[model samples]
Target: MYFCLFPTWHSKVFRNDVIFIYDKYFFNLWFDLYLKYFFLTSELIILISSLWV
Candidate 1:
């Protein structure tokens, strides 16, 4: 499972508390980037389609 991999993935192993903190921060940053990229692409698609029509 994805949860099981975290402990061994790092060069220096960390405690679960540390791993959990890392997971939370990584997820939040990735989620924010994904949302911004999704919105920008969607708007561009709409703009292009309208201009083409």
Candidate 2:
């Protein structure tokens, strides 16, 4: 089951405690994807900026 890793950021009244149990799998998956394309995106930005300059 998926739940918000950070509960405090959301409204307390809508928290729904039963589903808020901590799990790291989703975070790990997301982070892996972020890291996978992080450099590609950064490089693309740099390349675009250099062309504009």
TM-score of each: 0.70, 0.45
* Candidate 1 TM-score, C-alpha based: 0.70
Superposed model 1: Cα runs more than 4 Å off: 1-15
lDDT value, residue 3 of candidate 2: 40
In terms of TM-score, the best-performing candidate is 1
Once model 1 is optimally superposed onto the true structure by TM-score, how far is the C-alpha of residue 14 displaced, in angstroms? 8.0
Tens-digit lDDT string for candidate 2 (1-53): 22445433333445755433322444566677878799889999999999999
Encode model 1's per-residue lDDT on 1-53: one tens digit a residue. 65434433542455477766777676667678889999999999999999999
Model 1 residue 51 CA deviation (Å) reads 0.4
Per-residue lDDT, model 1, residue 43, is: 100
Q: What are the root-mean-square deviations of the candidates from the true structure over C-alphas?
A: 5.7, 6.0
